[model samples]
Target: MRHIDCQKRISLLVDGSLDGPAVREALDHLTECPDCARAYEKMVSLNNALTNVKPSLADSSLASKVKVRISGESNSAGYAWNFSLLKQVPIWALIAILAVGVGDMAGKTLTETLNMHDTSHNLENLIQDNGESLTDVLIDFGQSENGR
Candidate 1:
């Protein structure tokens, strides 16, 4: 099976939703493939984490008090209708971002123009394709001297 489909099966197995045959097959694959085994282990850990999680009581009262306080403190600032300070923000930020972008582009262009050259690091590939020895290539390079 494709790795993606197998991963889906792994999730189902962890959720205890896989059929008998599918569970068996998933387990079998897990046993043979280390990647699948690691994935299954992760699923088990995730399942344990989810099942053991409980809603906290500590924040219940805090949330209610916070909402009341926030409501008292709130104004048009929290709504889309208030655009006093936010209106200039987009224009200023856009201009600043564009300036920085232009500077970066100019620097990169200058550097590229200064270092305009192509270099080939294909010694291994050349040797493999031509079935030539490295020592022979080096000797030829040394003798030729002109980099032919």
Candidate 2:
């Protein structure tokens, strides 16, 4: 087999997972190819070292410490969601929007009132210029409608 193929099979050979023919081919390749031999040696050393390593026990307070940190993080995330993009908006901009809305409503009301006042003032001027009382104008309007 080629060096690349041998390199790929090195882990399986080190773990004793390869079959008889595969094992012989890998070993023969290892003896002949220096690069493959070095790779095989590294894999064997790593496997042995990992197998001899003892798993360390966790501290008794580790679980409680992790739980506390998770709870604190969740609470902070909740707070962040609560204080959203709307909260980041400037107070002056909100006040300006409110002021503009109120001003628009006030201006509309004033314009309507002024229009009503102007209509009444024009009616009064018409009556004074023609020297006609309110009743006289109404009677003339009635007669004109009847004729029509």
Best prediction by TM-score = 1
| Candidate 2 lDDT for residue 126 | 55
**In model 1, which range of ten residues has the least summed lDDT?**
118-127
Model 2 poorest 10 in a row by lDDT = 107-116
For model 1, the stretches where C-alpha displacement exceeds 4 angstroms are 58-148
How close to the true structure is residue 7 of candidate 1, measured as C-alpha lDDT?
89
lDDT per residue, candidate 2, 3-25, as tens digits? 57778899888888999999998
Evaluated at residue 65, the lDDT of candidate 1 is 93
What overall lDDT, based on C-alpha atoms, would model 1 receive against the true structure?
A: 0.78
- For candidate 2, the per-residue lDDT at 90 reads 98
User: Mind giving the per-residue lDDT tens digits that candidate 1 earns over 26-67?
Assistant: 999999989988998998998899889977777588889998
Each candidate's lDDT (Cα)? Answer: 0.78, 0.83
